[model samples]
Target: MHPALLEIARLGLHALPRASAGALRRYLETARPRLDLPPGEEIELFAPGARAVLARAFADIHHWLGQVSGRVPFFADIAQIAVPRPIPELAAAAAALPLLRADAPGHLADEAALAFLDRLAL
Candidate 1:
């Protein structure tokens, strides 16, 4: 488990399935500090080749996981290869989380997001 997941579990231990949207934000913020990743910045950088490398790697693992899914056995019982995300996306996502209000009315209460977030933290 990521440190953030553990923190989230500790945060919502009492609430369990009923943990609120604020918990999600707290989890994101908690996870953010340990990331040490560079912000993606949405292609704002001047460098072309290096930026492409970062963008392609980030997209391949996170945004475009589905495109690379079946080319190899994404469904296999064991993961033969593990692709890591670029530093930029990690930094960007963590930074952007604070801008969104976790207490907002439309937030989801699903645990699936927590699991996905945990993976993102990885």
Candidate 2:
């Protein structure tokens, strides 16, 4: 996995609610067999479940951020992560964020996802 992507997962997971984070961890644990496969193979086999799991995580993180920041629009507009893609694709997107836009919305969302993954020690 890309180092930047891993960092983003770390950030994202940290931003999630405790329950949501725990749930994701559990999912990862159960999905370990599929997750251990090579990137493309794992995604091809696990995309559906991965998308569902990640979508829930994203929504929970967004809600949590809104509650804490009191600026739903900021998160909604900037950090809204679409869940149609697999982790590798998402990680690529996170890796693609420009250094100049480190504080951009996508970056925030990426961070949240990274944090979540990091919490799982992924």
Tens digits of per-residue lDDT for model 1, 1-122 = 23223333443444444454455645554544444434432313233356456545554465345455644433342231232333333344444433323422244445654443434331
Name the 10 consecutive residues with the lowest summed lDDT in model 2.
99-108
TM-score for every candidate vs. truth?
0.23, 0.26
Please name the candidate that would achieve the greatest TM-score relative to the true structure.
Answer: 2
Go through the candidates in order and give the clash count of each. 1, 17
The residue pairs that clash in candidate 1, if any, are: 40-88
- Whole-model Cα lDDT per candidate? 0.41, 0.43
* Model 1 lDDT on a 0 to 1 scale: 0.41
C-alpha lDDT of residue 113 in model 1: 48
Error of 2 at 117 (Å): 31
